[model samples]
Target chain A: MRSSLLRAAHAPTELGMKIAFVTPRYGEEVMGGAEGAARSLAEHLVADLGHEVEIYTTCAIDHLTWADVLSPGVSQLHGVTVRRFTSAAGRDPKFSDLDARIRVAPSSRSIEDSVAWVAANGPVSESLVEALGDCDADVVAFYPYLFYMSVHGITRVRQPAVLHPAAHDEPSLYLPIFQRVFDSADAICFHTEAERSLVEPVLHTAATDQIVLGLGTGQASGSGRDGAAILGIAGRPYLVSVGRVDEQKGSTMLYEYFVEYKKRHPGPLALALVGPVSRPLPEHPDVVAAGIVNEADKWDIVAGAEVAISPSAMESFSLVVLEAWVARRAVMVNAVCGPTMEHIKASGGGLSFEGYLSFEVTLERLLGDAALREHMGEQGARYVASRYDWPVLIRRYEAFLESVVARGRRSEVKR
Target chain B: MGVDGFDLDQVRREIAAEVLARRTSGSVDAVEERRLQRLFEQYSPHAGGVGALSDALRSVDATIFIDPDVPVASSQPAGAAIKKTVRKANYWYMRWVTTQVTKALSNIAGVLHQVGSELDRINRRLDLVSNDTPAVIQLADADAWWHNRASEAVARAKGRVLVAACGDGSFVATLTALGHDAYGTDPRAEVVPTHGDSLDLRREGVIEHLDAVADAMLAGVVLTGVTEAMLPAQRTWLLRALDRVLAADGIVVLHLLKPEFLSGEARPVALELAGVEPLRPSTWVSVLHDRGFGVNLVDGGPDALIIASRGPRAN
Candidate 1:
């Protein structure tokens, strides 16, 4: 009883070095790349570096609907303390109206409209913002800047704000309200330098301390044999596209382009679209939509394909491209997607397409030369091995976090 | 290989040339870039003149007249015939009414434009009277006899130290070289990092810098340049700012010119414009004592370095 009373009086010392993450939605099953990246980072920081980790998130399971599926309260998930808050709103119709106006002319919108739009967008949990005020962690990290959790949590907390802005070149990034979000961050974390280059000048935060940390890719798995069989197709030359097969991911365009390519070539070349199909796919004899394959199967399909393609024009970081490289496969990317284009340009393991013509030309070249495909795949695999090995990434992350904590935002005193 | 070492630029160039060579038609659509507006900043009138708003107003004034001869055609054949007949019959009256309306509108626009010009003139004259900006000074001595002593005391201090009016940020550099977390604020923009520097230096006046800082945040503050020509009112404001922002255990290092030297012939031309010179070390001692600080003085040729510690500092 005496020991329990003592523990109650001095609680912080019991929980070693404390750190908290404020992500919009978090779970191993969560499909959003940024959310999953945050979860992976939190788990690794706890298991590898021995930092006490806490995840503050909403009860929403699906991002688009933001439906509160899980019960709100504290629980343990994968050895980390998880606090789930109920969202104040679900789907706000006004958000669409405001978003449409901002989309037409994003940079000129008033800061008031930007604030209203951010609040209008769902997953607004008042309890989460309140809890951030009471938190006594060494640092609070708010991931993926578009959500309401980051917009409110970073300003409410007294500790240093580390913003993991999984940002892309989108209209919402130009909103005036994001200036405050960028300025409030004691240190900004970016997934790619390309993302940094796009966001840094929005609020003149070039002098702000920052780190570019890409998510770690898993080890190579599965052989290239049963991938074609799993798709219910006979062995033939096929190109695979990974990630959410939705209109936003450029799936519709890929479909149209692939059909046209097959029409011109007049062969048994096929296209296999992978990952969760958010939108319905049109039926075609040459096209296969195998949605949400397991990790091993995903790698198997990547290994089996002639060229792994990411057709999306908007991406902050393309982890799928790196994964394909790990599986020793050549990839194709959209030229305008800054993050994926950065990856392809850096790796020399992929080709980029502007439109149908370039796509046709690059595809024909890669398909015609097997030796060229092998060389590109090997080059990409080597690049991934040298740059994104897990152990080195973790060490660099841990060291950077320690330095930030030690530095104490003392420079902010001169502001 | 590191991705940085990859020769992708050469390949990208090759692809660009190839795509351009194969362009047989203008079928490839032009990608329209989205229009963007810069962040809004409020316009303030200065001594120079008015901004783009005045130009826009002039443009509107020049185009306010009604064109009266707008075509009377309609898309429908029957409607077009009827509208044309009516417009011909009423053309004389329409021209007379439009001429009067245009005259009134044009006159209003011209008057509005004239009022804007008058306001611009008044604002420029007001600016001349209100602006009493300070000149940047390079008077702080980086190699004073007490440089090591001041740096040692600050290096052993507990929290962050600020060097106010740190010309060229030399004192800040000295403190940082000794591993003390130090930053400086100078009135001169050239003294900041853009002038071949890498230190933490902000371009702001001493009081402007302290106003942004949270209360009780600094463990130490080293002051220079700003002390020599401050008015009595500014000195009081400075003391209040210092008392608020400095921690209870904080120390202050002031590099001031000797009263005798300030009164000498070699004193700066800038100081001659000031109505009041700086206080002596003894006067600062009495003034700082009332604010609960203990003061000590160190001699450096023609200057006095006042080291004031709040109550009793641990270091």
Candidate 2:
């Protein structure tokens, strides 16, 4: 009883270091790659590193409307304290007009035009900006470079700001305003080496301040047989893809590729998709859309699969691919996604294809040769164990944060 | 009027200071927020309501100034004439700017075209120079390891020695300079600069040309660049194929990358060779052993050098 009381009263080293994460959207309902990562990392920072964590986010749940549906106040989510503020102008009807105008001719736009574009692009919350400025935290991390909260809020905060810019090679990234954000970041944490390489040439920041601290994946358990039985596919073999079933996530591409694969080579192999289906799946005997399975079942499905596919070309860091590797499953990824391709190249745990021909060949090789499949799976498991295990990743993250804080303190002393 | 008598500058300065303070406060205080709202309300109504009045004044001005029907003798007609002259001057200035911009763009395009052609010429010259000069092997540093290996292979074997995937043919040139009958083969020979014409270098596949060599005709074969790029099956085929042309006592030198030196991110150039997986030293040994070759490793520290001879083959 005494020990427990002491533990509750005086938490150990790095325990009281408060971190505030500013993302455009937050909560369990919000299902974006960056949001999910931010939430998970924040929770882990608190639970594992013993740090005090909070999130400052807009009251909007849906990214489409950035409306303040949630109450504008502080609330407890899991363990972290979430402060939700109102968006003064949420999703203006003329947002698309401004977006199109900017895209049509970005170079021709004046400073006022760009400013108006940012204002109309929605989720422009004066209150949120004020909250970010006033919030007292050791460090504030603004997620995803695209959102206005990250683009604008990051500069306003007095605390040392770290930008977890989930950047991709898109037209919006070329906007002149982001150049300042990237340049001003006290420390930048990238999800992958490719991401760092991409940002370094553009930002030209010192290497010491930028770190490639990839997210960790949970370990997988349970046999393939048990997982297959749980999914009601006891005997049938299928290729599983887990994520949002949308065109942007490359679900459409995966569906089309599977169709072409079936046309060329008819077999008992099926495609099992487990995610939030943004688009309706076409009726096919071989395709099964298991929408939003439980987390355990999702892991089970991954373990049961013959091969896991990640077809998205615009990924910053594919956590799903790492999960697939953890399940000892060989993965096939689109060659264009820098993060996934980097994973494949580094681990030699999976195969990547540029086109359908390469895909067909790689797929046939993995499916036809059981020994090869086993070898690749073993390679993947080893890679995940060595690099992505949570404990190892958490320690690295803790050390990186400690160093960043120390550096900030040194600069503060000098000031 | 009283409005003109009012000190508008003082009011503007006071309002600007109030807004700046509010913004810097980072939070809305109830009393201050109401004050700020009232200040905005005081001026927000008339901010954009002048459109109709401005349009009417502009029309009246245009009729008096730009209209050709206005009498030039009237006092107002003098202002109209001056306005017309100013409009024409502005139009001419714009036209001059447009013409200059067009000329400048045209000149830039011409220069770019010239630069493109020059680049093309340089590229062609580079291709020729690359073929004529030895290609720099961008891998492990060149040391006495190549010289020692070449000399050892020549001394140990009889008949013509072939070096496969001999990048740049510099090693072949070295052997030739030593008066040993050494020939090099590189599929990308056009890109790799070579020594003088006396060096026996061929622009073809090492395997395809090796098939043409007479049995027991070649004393030694040195395989390098493409060794790590072949699948285990392909490597097995290569060794078996070598047995057909190579003398029973001839030695085959396989230069592979040391797996210890390899990092997860350092992609060996050989990984791009289609239909192949990167190989480790152990895999090379097993592959060589499977094709009836007794293995001998030459430890050049960083390099994975293996010498293979015909022996009891592993099935």
Which regions in candidate 2 have their CA more than 4 angstroms from the true location? A1-15, A92-121, A206-208, A221-234, A409-415, B1-315
The per-model DockQ list reads 0.04, 0.01
TM-score for chain B of all predictions? 0.58, 0.50
Chain A fold similarity by TM-score, each prediction:
0.92, 0.88
User: Which docking band does candidate 2 fall into?
Assistant: incorrect
Alpha-carbon runs more than 4 Å astray in model 1: A1-16, A223-225, A409-415, B1-14, B25-315
RMSD of each: 13.0, 26.5
Overall lDDT per candidate, in order of appearance: 0.73, 0.66
In Å, residue B25's CA in model 2 sits off its true spot by 71
Native contacts recovered by candidate 1, as a share? 0.03
Give one digit per residue, the lDDT tens place, for model 1 in B21-122: 655443343220000000000011110111244644634544455655657667886887787888888889889999998899888887887888898899
Q: Pick the candidate with the highest lDDT.
A: 1
Alpha-carbon deviation at A349 in model 2, angstroms: 1.0
lDDT, model 1, position A206: 43
TM-score of each: 0.62, 0.55
Cα error, candidate 2, residue A276 (Å) = 1.9
Predicted candidate 1 versus true structure: per-residue lDDT over A1-415, tens digit per residue: 1123433553434544567899888886675478888888888877776667788999997777788999899998877889999998965777778776776556777888887888788788989999998876777888889988888777788777788898776678878778778767877777876777666545445445556778777797775567788788867778999888887777877887788678768887899999778787789999999988877788888888889998887778888889889988888897767788888777789888866767767888779878767777987898788777777676666665664565664332223
